[model samples]
Target: MERTSPPLRTVARAFEVIELLWELNGATLAEVTRRMDLPKSTVHDYLRTLEMVGYITRIGETYQLSYRFLTTGGRLRNRSRFFQTARPVVRRLADETGEVASIGVEEDGECVILHAMRGEKSLELGIYPGLRVPLHAHATGKVLLAHLPEAYAEETIFSDGLAAVTDHTITDVNRMKRELSAIREQGYAADWDEQILGMGTVSVPIVIEDDLVGSISVSGPTGRVEDDDYRAELLKGVREAANTIMVGYQYGH
Candidate 1:
């Protein structure tokens, strides 16, 4: 039997301190000590070490995360071939559809938005890069789940147990599986206020050589996006954009 190794307490504590600072947006020495229930000296040492590494900064008495995280995240996003290839296509999709266009991928059993673009008529729904949402709750997520292996999809659904985000969100395992199967058959997936009330989304997978790369989607108010004519238009735009991204990624174009 394979045995799992215990996590290092020191490293875990250090990460805990960092997460605390992030959650509080910033914290003073006393605040960190109180929140973590650790010795003031130990918290100070951790803060000082992080500051030395340039991951955090101390301004007066408050210690906050630095721009280093942004820099690191930017570099990582740029390094992804999928993101690089999809950027222009997604932007064009937004422009053509006059709505919000986004690309997302599954990570850690959740869907992470890699990039999103706003069109002239786009509604501000607060979606941004790195935003993580449940895989069973949105069009991009459901499309990804449809394309992923059955075993992985089953594990994700059973383990996470489908927490609903809105009244329209699907919480039943069998029902969700049926929807995923329908998405596969239809080559697309849609959400009708599943993640946010009054919002609707249509998503198509970016598959290359039978392997799932990511998903592309367009979103807007449910009234506009779910209308028969407008929904057809948005679907065409997303499917074309997904095709373009796939070709660009595969051919280095």
Candidate 2:
């Protein structure tokens, strides 16, 4: 079932004001008006509501975001149980494939790294827990995008816009759409130096309860990853690891 957004009201606008303050690291009322492109009166109303709710604080001449939002997002993340289930699975995939293995979840149309395991042999692909990467420039993003609802997929891609991070990155909207379609059919996405130089990666979506909830990935230097057999074996191991996590997710274990 599609989730319904909260009702649009003063409360919702107050939250948006807090987010903008957080993004700006605090701003004057004039700056907020310019960034939000709203009338001064409207911005002041939202700021007053947010201050009343303890979500933002006004100190002297500037408004600042409070830590309450951090607590809320942190609580939601801790309740997900995603890292606990993915840790061992990622380790196993790294051991089997002899490549860096990772598990990530989608948040706000971006990939948030939750767990990663490095192979015994050093690989140059840089990934670690808590590292966040944009969805437009990564194989992991492609897998997650391919599995999302069509409307969400289209909106994110269009909104984020395809700016080339590297020479090999897909920069055209139509090309990206076609690429995602292929990933959906093949059950995986691959990139050769698309985001970083001399690195390659494969990403596969993790499905549970018929929802595309996360992604599993294997990455290594181009020489090892470009080998056809090595790539195939890595994809196989990634799929197996994702399946393991899916089973764990299904049973609440």
Candidate 3:
């Protein structure tokens, strides 16, 4: 095996604190220390440095991320050809399905929602652009995982520890391997109350020029998705949206 060095501990710690803050929206020193299992002094040093650098803001004993992160996301979204191409496709899928449709890509061992559209009947599920989700937790996530090289996929799962959000989440490695294989064979993936208790998603990979770019999904309440005819319509719409994105991307490029 080729040896690879780990990231510098200081840099990693900084990012760990940042991620904790993102997850919590804002955190007190004690909250961060308790959640991340880091020393208070260490957390304090990182928080001070981050706040001093204008990457975070401290207000009334709570530390929150600066708006710079949103600005960064907007800049990156503008530059992303995939995001540009997939945006309208997501909108159309939402319109057709009366659910929320999204396009997402793999980043740093997680799936990040790049764009999302909500239909008139869509329930606000709290999903949004720039939201990062686990690779083994949702439909888009499974699609992302199914498309990666086996070694890379396994590495992501091993490194992330398959953190379970619900009782239905797949936590066993061997079982997850089998699930990924099934997703690959099926060409699309479904989430039935795995990530959240009531939501369901059906996703298809957005492939461009024979390469997997990302996944498109139509997600809504499980009741709507459980209807057999409605499920069929949702799957068809999602797949068509993926095809449209691929065509638009190939043509525009």
Candidate 4:
């Protein structure tokens, strides 16, 4: 029989190698081999193939991601209706509340900030656009997680292993499950210094025609945000903003 091609494992390794290039910024043969603990020959072959397909580039014996792969994602972001509709609302919320406001989309078991507006306050922990936050930590992540199917929620919690980032972080799966259940009942989720010291956040899901489109959030110092009254007010504002986006999304259809 003729020699068969490599298995699916080969294809997966090839993609993993491509991902490694993104994290490396640019990696030499030695760097790639050492980082991935793979043979130099295998890495070199993957790099060559990626370069040929315009997915990666070789520069002075280093490999980095090429513009081709980024182009597709860039185009998608540019055309996204979610970003367009949510940006103004996020800006308005930030300006009104004088606190950081953000919009996050569920991606790869995490909440990825698509857009954000920094408040007037100095020294704020701003979540810039394109920042990836784990679903186990932040308010936006919690709200999105609360809206997911039970199976997905369990899978995410179990897969992520719920590492604790702060003393206040809920690392126990059962506790987080209960919290998410409460969030669903309350129509919002709140994080109290879970990810970072002195920071608190409130988030609400942006539902469109009963679909979990995304989440919108407000965040600031825990001192200013942790009170029950303040939390309720912030949650109300987030809900209003999310509703505005949902209305536009539904009406535009």
Candidate 5:
């Protein structure tokens, strides 16, 4: 990579330490030094800088990220056009279905729940923001994958492999590929105990101007979600909600 200005190695190292802390959740100075392959004194200096900035906190010798990151993340989410615009539709879905209504987007090829509207009953199910699900294992993920360029999708899926979370999770690449194709053709995706057992989810992609912006899903216990007529009714609502969100997104754009 070419740089117009010289890159600051110290700043880069500081970020590397932050990422390492995030990955490990928390770590001791010794652990950070060993994991980062950096000198202990240098690692301590970096950790001290992060702590002084209030982005990291120290308890004894263990270093962990502070809740300040949450504030930053909240600001980012609050400013998002998609999150703000889709929230009304998400709330309606939750109110009408008594299920967990959520929006997910791909980050580092993993499905990250951006926000959710939960019905009273959905509190027990516990789908929330910051939840990460494998791309091959959930309805929201498959919807995003189906919209990705075919070769890129294939490479990502195959490289990641189908990590089965339940008996129903699809582990075969060929089957998954065919299913993704169907998701694209049908404009929706479904998951039956694919990520968490007894949970069924149905999702539709929110697209605007050929861009796969995000996916919206309704999740509930499989017994209620598996009923044919009920599934059909829920699907109709989901599609309408997705279409409305996309239309609003396009208009704003």
Candidate 6:
């Protein structure tokens, strides 16, 4: 059996400090020390090291993340052929549907929005690139989950235990499994005020040569999304966008 190496404590602590700073949106040396329960000198050293590497910035006494992260994230996104190919298609879908259109992929058992574009009537739901959410709480997430390997999907679902984000969110494991099965058969997923109240979403998977690339979704107010005529239109738009992205990615366009 292959044994995995344990995580390095020094590196782990450094990441913890970074996450703490992110959660606080910036923190004084004293504040970091208090929150991390680490020695003041230790926290200061971590902060200084991160600052020296340009990952953190010191303004007055507050230490915050630097734009270096943004640069790194942008470079990573640019490297993804799938994301690059999906960008224009997703933007067009947003324009056609007049809602929030996004592409999402599963990472570390969670759904991460790769890119989100707002249309003329899109709601300001704080959806953005790099936003991560539970896989059972939204249309994009459900589509990705439904397409993933059975063992991996089962592990993710059981481990996460289906925490409810809103009253409409599915909290039962069996029910969620049934939903995934239906999604597989129907080739799409829909969420009505599940992740966020008043918001509705419809998503379709982007499959290339039987491989699940990711998912594309359109979101809007429940008032419009729940309407039979409008919902059908949105579903048609999202499905077409997903197909465009899949074909573009497969052809290396």
The candidate that wins on TM-score is 6
Question: Which regions of candidate 4 fall more than 4 Å away from where they truly are?
Answer: 1-7, 67-69, 122-126, 158-161, 227-233
Tens-digit lDDT track of model 4 for 62-125:
8888888668767777788898888789999988888899999998688898888887972468
User: Could you give candidate 5's per-residue lDDT for residues 109-210 as a string of tens digits?
Assistant: 789899988887774666788888988899989999888877776666676678888889999989998998899899899887899888889999988888
Task: Decide which is better by lDDT, 2 or 5.
Answer: 5
lDDT of 2 by residue, 52-85 (tens): 8888889997999877776876666567777777
Q: In candidate 1, which residue pairs clash?
A: none
Question: What's model 1's TM-score?
Answer: 0.95
What are the runs in model 6 whose C-alpha is more than 4 Å off? 1-6
Task: Indicate the TM-score of model 6.
Answer: 0.96
Off by over 4 Å in 3: 1-10, 16-49, 58-63, 158-161
The 0-to-1 C-alpha lDDT of every candidate, in the order given, reads 0.90, 0.82, 0.87, 0.84, 0.88, 0.91
> lDDT by residue for model 3 over 1-253, one digit each (tens)?
3336646889878888898998999999999999988788988999999999888999999999999888888999989889989887788888888899998999878899999999989999878998998889999989988888778776666655788879988888788878888988988888778888889999998766667799999999989887879888999888888888888888986
Top-down TM-score ranking: 6, 1, 5, 4, 3, 2
In Å, residue 35's CA in model 5 sits off its true spot by 6.3
lDDT of 6 by residue, 1-253 (tens): 2236546888889999999999999999999999999889998999999999999999999999999999999999999888999999988998998899999998878899999999998989778999999999999999999989898877766555899999999999999999999999999999889999999999999888878888999999989899999989999999888878777787774
Per-residue lDDT for 3-57 in model 1, tens only?
Answer: 3654688787888988999999999999999999988999999999999999999
Candidate 5 worst ten-residue window by lDDT: 1-10
Error of 3 at 238 (Å): 0.8
RMSD of each: 1.9, 5.2, 3.5, 4.7, 3.6, 1.8
Error of 6 at 100 (Å): 0.6
lDDT of 1 at 84: 94
